[model samples]
Target: MVNVNCNILQAVDKNLMIADKIFRSRLMVGTGKYETVQIAKQSIHASGASIVTAAIRRLQINHPFEEKSLFKYLDWNSLWLLPNTAGCTTVEEAVRAASLGRELCKKIGQSNNNFIKLEIIPDYKYLLPDPIGTLKAAEYLINKQYTVLPYIYPDPVLAKQLEELGCSTVMPLGSPIGSGQGLKHLDSIRVIIENAKVPVIVDAGIGTASDAVQAMELGASAVLTNSAIANAQQPHIMASSIQLGVQSGRLAYLAGRMNELTQAQSSSPIIGISS
Candidate 1:
């Protein structure tokens, strides 16, 4: 039997790229839904993710005077902050949020960090993003020199359009945000991944590490998971699990899977067998 070595195959995959920065770990965990700030920090550390995305509108990044500021607890030097426009429902709101995110990054000493996770979520029930609004917001933000990572539905056409608009990465939801439903739009996401020039990071509704693996195995550059880890019974453990899943899936993709057969076949050679 031939021994399979993954580290040797790592050369082909290299690192997860977004704009100019490269991440070793493809599991980008979200900084939300945790019980406490301490837990959130612990989970992030355990996940071993170089990039951590947070909701700019929900979290307090400016109020350093307050006891519960995100900047105070998390170490900026190690982790890259990806400010997300989660609460915005309109193009105008999302664009303004992206601007605020840029200024916040500058103020926090991440002067070159212009990464913004654009989300125009007008759908209150499912928290789905508005494709038209997202496109408009992304176009405006990209013009301002901000690296926009737009959260969109699993539409290959829209993903292509966003890629052409100079958005850094196209984030398509596996399901609804914070729902933990897990990759409901699997086929559509696969098409997006196949056609996308930029990184296709699966953003939401990942309930388990298995789901994360599914997304990665289908050739996603990375996955941004929050509820799957944060809402887990053990957030820190789940975070680590996600890290493993992302790595495993990426390695599997790089290894190149075998072709499928319609019927079962014998493992042993039949023609060469001695009668």
Candidate 2:
């Protein structure tokens, strides 16, 4: 078996799969819904995550001084921005969104090969990814020399398909988006992780520190969380918790786990009775 290795763990690798590089951070964060950009930056720093997700939006210049860029306040040296096609519902839309992201990144003096978080969600309420459409987008983008990291359901087959299409990584939701329900499809996630040729990132529905730890322990390459930490009373502290959780999980996985037992064993000695 190929052993995992990183700064936080000995046997588990926390390297994030960007276009052609492997980033050494397992904690991926979103740049959304923060009270302020400062707070968001602080939380990101606290999380110790090297990669942060950014959404691609059309250029709307309401005012000359109006800052519409999310990357304005974030520390670029420490964090690599992973632009996402969050609101796209179709393959065409997703492709356009990713192109827009690439353009925007170039306009802002960022790398062109930055990874794209392909999120094709048709339904507004559930926010579930359109897996078929996502695959389409991934195929196109990968062909176009873009680093694609698609967010989809915990489907092992989908992961394999993405890998074959030359995607850098596949992000599967732990549960519904923003639900904070933790890992429900844990078994499926394990299957995806086990079979994937690329990195596997646990994307959404992570509520607490333990949730992140659980995902990492199951051999997931990394995790992306936002609501659970950003919505907390103390977001900075919560970010630290998430960082620790990722580290803890990676360490535990490296340490290896005890097998589950079907029956309980008697600890007390029954030597006299047996004799």
Q: How well does model 1 score by local distance difference test?
A: 0.86
TM-score of each: 0.94, 0.88
lDDT of 2 by residue, 132-199 (tens): 89888888888888888899999999889988889988899999998999999989999999998788
Off by over 4 Å in 1: 1-12, 271-275
User: lDDT scores for all predictions?
Assistant: 0.86, 0.82
Question: Please, what are the lDDT tens digits per residue for candidate 1 over residues 1-275?
Answer: 12143355366678888898887778898877788988888899888899988777875656642777656788888888899999999988888778778877877678999999999988899888899898888889889999999999989999999999999999999998888888999899999999988999998999999998899899999999988998889998988888878878887887779999999999987997888
Clashes in model 2: which pairs? 4-11
Backbone clashes, each candidate: 0, 1
| Winning candidate number (lDDT) | 1
RMSD of each: 3.0, 4.5
